[model samples]
Target: MSNKVILVVLDGLNYQVARDCMGYLNGLIEQKKATLYPIQCELPSMSRPLYECILTGVPPVLSGIVNNQIVRLSNEESIFSLAKSQGKVTAAAAYHWVSELYNRAPYDAVRDRFTDDETLNIQHGRFYHWDHYPDEALFLDAESLRQQFNPDFLLIHPMNIDDAGHKHGLDSRQYRNSARAADIYLSNYISTWVDAGYQVMVTSDHGMNDDLSHGGILPEEREVPLFVIGDTFTHAETTVKQTELCGLCCQLLGLEHCKPYAPEMIAL
Candidate 1:
């Protein structure tokens, strides 16, 4: 297989916020290791639905993911399962649902869920959330898991920005500042993988409107940013649908996407 892949999900980041807040990302862009794609997530742009879009390359309407708590995935192919078929080791640091989708089967012992329980846990502070955990904490967890498993494919979801947007409006100073913080954290975390000869990917589940809520068709809430960075493979994508990511990830890993679900290719 190709060098390992690290997929970083900056939950609920909008394109404008990404441009203004994520200054460090330009480092990768300059290396031609990064490409910014303008994408509008599917309707009901909540975590589960939009995540399904990135993971399965399908929209919420077809994926049938209405809420974050629903554990049952649609009868569709997923990147994790595809990676397994390629015999690539996979791991994920994400919400509870991620554990549900990619539990034990092919996963090794280093594969397990983590809690943000500060003291009893390894790193997360007492302020962790039940639904989403901050990137700060997930980064620590991902590092530990990676060191142990050295997985071929790793999916990470850092979610404080989503929480900030929900508790405070997207226009609020908190949301903007949190978006910036998200950028810095991801930049630092991904660098380790790049230094270790791994490909890095950064994207978002959905966007947030001024009201701090999604699930609509507004550009602010629907548009997200996708960035891919690596030394071995560096290319640009001017426009791409959100549904195309799953197939793209599989392709990057040197594997085939599920039949009939090819990711829309961008003209280089």
Candidate 2:
């Protein structure tokens, strides 16, 4: 089986918002017959740290990526580096802080100096707003990248719904509209990839509260959805918490020896 994986990060996406789109997603799930896991996101439920954890299979304490602004390197190497060592092709495209922290020019400079034949593409763009409707351009760009690179691993980050929720509270019409927009865009992307025979994994960095704010360890902010769709996946529901997701991705990608956070359930 080709261990191709696509990771999609929906920035600031709450479980409730995902639930709202569940009808659409459920149909896709049935059509694709993919596995679904409800995973808890990281603590503080912020962006940078959560992405770091997903990329490295280690917590912020070990990855030294604790927030959205600053980064410090810990001993743990990222999954990107690990994939490179295994001769697996990898590609990434993201918006906002997650992309910024990982694809910093200085970091890229150093990586380029040592790595060849490894493909990493990071596109920067603004979050949601009519002004950025063309932001869907990123998806088109990513599709082009996928065709060109045919990477074993691919990551895409979409940020508008989260941006809207943060600015206008989760219940606002704007937030709802943004959520709907995200659903449309995501559905299109996943369906396209599924037709192309790629296994797609979708999740969020962390969730937001009804008030559209979070930096706490609350369940509303930490609970996120994890869904896997493709021929490679077996359709079933598994209760997977956030920390366990990194390891699960590694497993799905044929890196069975990779270490993952021990599964632990937090009371809702």
- Top-TM-score candidate index: 1
lDDT against the true structure, per candidate, is 0.70, 0.63
Of candidate 1, the 10-residue stretch with the lowest lDDT total is 118-127
Cα RMSD of all models vs. native, in order, equals 5.8, 5.4
| Cα lDDT of model 2 by residue, 31-69, tens digit | 755545667776657777888777776777666777766
- Model 2 segments beyond 4 Å from truth? 30-32, 72-75, 99-135, 261-268
Query: TM-scores for all candidates?
Result: 0.83, 0.81
TM-score of 1: 0.83
Q: Give the range of the ten consecutive residues with the poorest summed lDDT in model 2.
A: 122-131
